[model samples]
Target: MRATMAARGHGRRLAAALWLVVVAASAASARFVVEKNGVKVLSPRSLRGHHEASIDAKLATGCDPFGAASPFKSRSGRPVVLLVDRGGCYFALKTWNAQEAGAAAVLVADIVDEPLLTMDTPEEQTPDMAFLANITAPSALISKRFGDALRLAAADSSSSSSSSSEEVVIRLDWRESMPNPDSRVEYEFWTNSNDECGARCDEQQSFVSSFRGHAQLLEKSGFAAFTPHYITWFCPEEYLQTRQCEAQCINKGRYCAPDPEQEIGAGYDGKDVVLENLRQLCVHRVASARNVSWVWWDFVVDYRVRCSMKEEKYSRQCARDVVSSLGLPVEMVEECMGDPEADADNDVLRTEQIVQVGQGSRGDVTILPTLVINNVQYRGKLESTAVLKAICAGFKESTEPPVCLTQDLETDECLNNNGGCWRDDKTNITACKDTYRGRICECPVVDGVQYQGDGYMDCKAVGPGRCAVDNGGCWKGTRDGKTFSACAGSESLSGCSCPAGFKGDGLHCEDIDECGEKLACSCPSCSCKNTWGGYDCSCGSGLLYIKVEDTCVGKSTSAMGWLATALVLSCLVGSGIVGFAFYKYRLRRYMDSEVMAIMSQYMPLDSQTTENRPLREEAVQA
Candidate 1:
């Protein structure tokens, strides 16, 4: 089922849906106040907060709809308006032009129904243009509705009979903040607006078309925004293929980091090739294997960590060396490296699997270094001890493995804060626990009595006689010359005791019958007898014990017969009443239909008959 789900891309689809569900919850909105006639009007703005730009002067439109410099500039220092149309000009260019023309800030009005967008520039730009693209002056995008209302308000004020220089003002105040990453992931306007291609289009006309399609798909899938994050690279023609592949990834709106330059020579190491081949192998093995525990432990947990910690560069040669060092597989590397199609397929498959695993983990892949045991992912800290605990908890066996049961197995938790050692039997507490501050052992309590306080957070009862409060059998000592019980010390706050009806050693007690010495049964009409640690009541000669009511009542077979008869009579009467009501309803409907037919035959169906008739009423009662 998981394989089928992965193949169908169910994991990515689910992750997208989940991200969208929490988009609003994870993101904050831009603070902008727009008022008309002292009443605030609702408007959507960019999530990126900028400096406040208040405009009380007449609203001035930029010379170009895209905010590019025109023959006429906006009134100096006045807020300039721009239209969200055309794709050729970047948002930065439009805003820069307005800024250069002395506009305090630029407001790009939406031409479509989409909410205002948080604009970003193209990935690659000239050095000088990049500086200008920062949008230093407060800038924002406003909805088409808000722009229209502002225009109408301006027009209304412009035509007012009373001449007042003061114009209708629209103030936009931006608080310092940024949109949430999840909210940015949910932006799907690109998919709807870019109609040239779909998410799964087979072919495209050009690179731009392909790039837009891929970006739209990524945004719709809640992966990233619809803008590429490019990394400039300097490479030779030999590695042009690599550049092309990386460009494809970048154009899809994914962050692309340039790989280290490859030096092609007669003595080329083929390190990159080997690393790629090994990655493909790992993905294939993980995908095909029925059990992933060994694969993760051997390759991911052990080999990956060792290689990373040793600063061993990940290459094809490094992978082969690691495999040889592990003393298992060198033949499989060649097999994996031989199939290029398999490499690509496995790459895509690995992505799907990772997303599936991530969603199964916690709906967030950012919490990395994850551990999955028995199909359940651990959401705790990325520590070996934490992982071990999760894996142990997944076991369903009656007996734990020897390693799991032994405290001799070293762990960082045990080394920290004198956590102390475990007993050979795993049930007994050691003397090291006497002065230990942390948890040492998980001692079991007697039946009917549970250990008080947290079991593992802090083993306050680990010291000598501390278990006395819960009556645990841990320690004992003598008071003066007399031998006292384990928890008889006045300083010992922890001890155990039997419940009301039980008695024995604190750690091992049994229930006792109190009714044997006391007249506990109060049922007057029943015979009482002691049973186990409790009592049972039985009805006397002519009575029946009703367990539901917990009482004895007079037995009456005749009364039962009467009740059965009454139930039958009631059911019969109810059925008869329903049948009569239904029959009456049907008869009334049939009679009404007949009456309507008779009336139609005697009288005209319309008032026109009265107007057409000459002194009607049966020709004056002839």
Candidate 2:
């Protein structure tokens, strides 16, 4: 019996897959250009993954529309945009088939001349639709008239093989699809917290987790405003008393959601999803009131991880724990949510319903996991980078921030291991700088001192003010109320050296013994003792050591005084002796001269007789 039931379930799933093959159309306003006969023709079209502004590729016709007919082969070995008639398969299956045949993109032309409609993915997931997730190539839907023109151009080019210029080319342009009317972009994310809804749920959760950083950055910097919305339906009045309504709705069936398990007695009912959605809405509303609306991302991500449906932990208690952990006001969120059991309208949930309707250029958001930027729907893979690029494109030219202009989003490498850069644990200073491209390691200037070195490994403080920061990364110590630093009065620009009385590289210094090494106080009467950063010396009791001369002197140094006084007396005595000798010799000479003059008065003195003195003798003779 169990085997039979399982086989029945498989058969139902297969039937659902077949039923989904019928093409469904959505409203889109993007346009594409076709080049034929040396002229460009513009036509209205709707493109899926409307992210890029323009994509140019050669046209290839008569490819399998359902991908089961024949493989698509391109002649030029370049990117080919495969054209097919819209009928045999789902839009997603067509795109997937073209992708498998090595087509860069696909354009499905409508059989009738109706307005262009968006080619969307299947609403429900099935085993046959498993290739939906791998449909990365962009696709579009064109009118019947444009399709015929492209076919004729291709036919003409193929028949006349001599001229390659006759080949048809088309350009998918989405530049004007999303308008950039202002400097700031306002976007809305239509999502649900139901984790059991399969691919759509997973996509929503993944986008929230990966895009949280960028969203918060844009919000905090005032570059963008983001709003999250959840879709809810009101049960019909006829089914109000049914078991489905009771299990799937709250507030007397006013707001409801499809049962997650799609069964009455299965795991989680629709009411559970609705309540969680209300709680998330309340979280955002409360956070926005507090002027920190970005915390909504934190609460959602945390709740998804801690309280998942698969783990059977998706309960009120788990959500409360997540809310409290993020410091959000639980009482405020509760008050905003109001009584789920009350038979009245919830102001928060009611507002969400009113905002769900189409307004201005945007249409009603009927699709799950939809992104609307600048009041226009963004149809593409719900990935972070792709969504970011579309949001950036919504900004006016030259009004984009550095985050948008950069090649990639900011990785915040400094948050992890300081980006493998140099850091001072004591000062909490790091050389890593987070930028839009990634992280860079460069020495930083702190206080007035600039650091110099290879920032990845080392950053040594330099300049006169370097000592103020970690003692210039040098060795320092203090003892007995005395402190010494190897960086004190340093003259070199970088590197460390031991101070005067210390030994070792400046990184690690030890006191030196002046007396032991005979470097100081070398006199016999001197003694030395090692200190923390230097040495101390003392002389014997009766001696004093001269630091300048590095010599010992007697304390009772009267000997130096006596030697000075003796030298002064000896100079005086020698002067007196020389004076006396000179005076006596002069007196003797005077006496001899007086005797000679007395003798000469009586007669000419023999010693005075000379040729010049002969006149005196002659006068005497006359």
Candidate 1 residue-pair clash tally: 11
The TM-scores, one per candidate, come to 0.24, 0.56
What tens digits encode model 2's per-residue C-alpha lDDT throughout 258-328? Answer: 99989997999999999999999999999999999999999999999999999999999999999999999
lDDT of 2: 0.70
Q: Compare the candidates by TM-score and give the number of the best one.
A: 2
Best by lDDT: 2
Candidate 1 lDDT at 538 equals 81
Lowest-sum lDDT 10-residue window in model 1: 13-22
Candidate 2 ranges beyond 4 A from true positions: 1-78, 408-622
Candidate lDDT (C-alpha), each: 0.36, 0.70
The sequence of per-residue lDDT tens digits that candidate 1 reaches over residues 1-622 is 0000000011110000000000101112333212111113321122112222222111222222322343222222334333222233665665555555444444544555653333444435455554442344444444556444444443443345554423322343221111221212221110010111221111111223323433333334443322111112123435435634433222221212222233233222233322342343453353234322123123332344344312545445655566556444567545543443232333332343344322321232221122233322222222333333333333232222333333532232444543444332233433222211123445333343334433344333433444444334433333346332334334545555543444666555554554455445445775767654356778788787765666677778646967999999999999999999999999999999999888888777666576767767669889
- Indicate the TM-score of model 1: 0.24
